[model samples]
Target: MKLPLFPLNAHVFPGGKLSLRIFEARYLRMIKERAGKEPCFAMGMLEDREGGAEVLPWATQVRMVDFSQLEDGLLGIVVEGVQWLHIEDITTDDDGLRWADCKPVSIWSEPNHEQDASINSALLSLFGQYPELGKLYPEAAGQSMDWSLQRWLEVLPIDAGNKVSLLNQLNSKPAFEFVNNLLHQGDP
Candidate 1:
């Protein structure tokens, strides 16, 4: 399917939230056209380049949930990731809006283990300390291993290259182990 693409220098995973400040004319038009139809778009991470911006292959299908004007007088939008997408082809319009032919990719399924209470509590406490992040998500954000795993992947201050490598995995076991190790590292 052809979807409008917004490449950012950030990582967004399934069930994660992202806030963007829209100012460019092409994106402004894209948002206006997408307002009532689906409110969905594809998000790709900007790849490292010598001078120009490049987007990675893996991306997330995000749905806009809220919009407002920021203090600096720019249009701000909050979006939540719905699923993963793989770009088949991409083309940019004259106005610089990118449209991509994409296919949805299935992310890792819930692991066989039960939710880790300690990790969940830590995530909850972190969210409690920052209500702004809490407000972007649904009430059930960090309640499950799947949700917690995705959230951890989203918020961790890790390298984008590592994130892209992790996302390319066919199974989520590696990601699960990674998050599990990180959580254990904080143990007293």
Candidate 2:
């Protein structure tokens, strides 16, 4: 789908939560216009930096969940991860941020019963091994199995490139495998 773009060096995984500080004038305007009305938008990362502020050429989609204006006229917002997307084309304004044409590598679909069961069971197993996560994610034990799995994927602290790669994953098996590798430092 076509999306208004925000290019950054970081990646946001689907079902993840992102907190951002917006100080640039253009982005400030973008947020002011968007705020509560249109919380959903696309975000991408600059693989490389050119002389100007434009991104390298790709981006992902992101949705804004909560935002507030800081003392400096900047915006502090909470965003939820949506999907990984590739930029098909981009157009920039006077400021660095750009608008891009893009689409996700994998569209989200409601998990089936079997997938749900597997995810739930996996979470139970993971919690047993990594109980520390329970402090930050108290809901882990009570959330729907699918949502718990998705949240675990979202909180990953990797860069934008990795998030995009994970988004390209086609099935629950691959997605779970990728996340497992990440947890184990097995991904290269």
Candidate 3:
């Protein structure tokens, strides 16, 4: 099926958090109309521009998890990425937005259980060092992890391109490892 596209600079994995500011009239109306039925949207990292905004071949679908109104009357919503989709065909609407027919791709899991465990352990260790991040992810500090990895990813400062690159990488182990290095670098 085809869906509206929101080209961004970062990548969002399934279960990742994506907070967005909604200002366009069409999207505002879309949010108002689909708020209850399907308050989810898809995001893709745009490729080199041809002059105007355009949709790329890859995108991630996300669901709205929180919504708030800004003082200026604009809307802001936090969304969680659910899946990655591959664009098959795209068409531009009058407003210049691109809509596309796409298919979702299967995510690759670490081939070895030990690698999975290692990545999880590394993430836990990394999260433990950042107490301040607990304010943003309280549950991560609690007894056990009930939330998905994507949720934790949402809070990271890694941009859309980085997110997409992680998603497109070989496997989860390397992805988390990359995150570990990036976090360590940012930690000072």
Winning candidate number (TM-score): 1
CA lDDT of every candidate: 0.79, 0.60, 0.61
What TM-score does prediction 1 earn?
0.87
TM-scores of the candidates in the order shown? 0.87, 0.64, 0.68
- Model 1 scores what on Cα lDDT? 0.79
- Choose 1 or 2, whichever is better by TM-score: 1
Worst 10 residues of 2 by lDDT: 107-116
Tens-digit lDDT string for candidate 1 (1-188) = 78899988877788789889999999999899887555378888776777976787778988888899999999999888987888899999999999988998777633446556766677777788888886776575436766776787788877666776766676556777787788788668
Worst 10 residues of 1 by lDDT: 108-117
Pairs in clash, predicted candidate 2: 43-60, 44-59, 44-60
> Which residue runs does candidate 3 get wrong by more than 4 Å?
47-54, 109-112, 115-136, 141-165, 183-188
- Cα displacement (angstroms), candidate 2, residue 28, comes to 0.1
Q: Flag regions of model 1 displaced more than 4 Å.
A: 49-53, 109-111, 186-188
The better-scoring model by lDDT among 1 and 3 is 1
> Which residue pairs collide in model 1, if any?
none
What is candidate 3's TM-score against the reference?
Answer: 0.68
Arrange candidates, best TM-score first.
1, 3, 2
Tell me the spans in candidate 2 whose CA falls farther than 4 Å from its real position.
Answer: 48-58, 70-73, 104-159, 181-188
lDDT of 3 at 40: 54
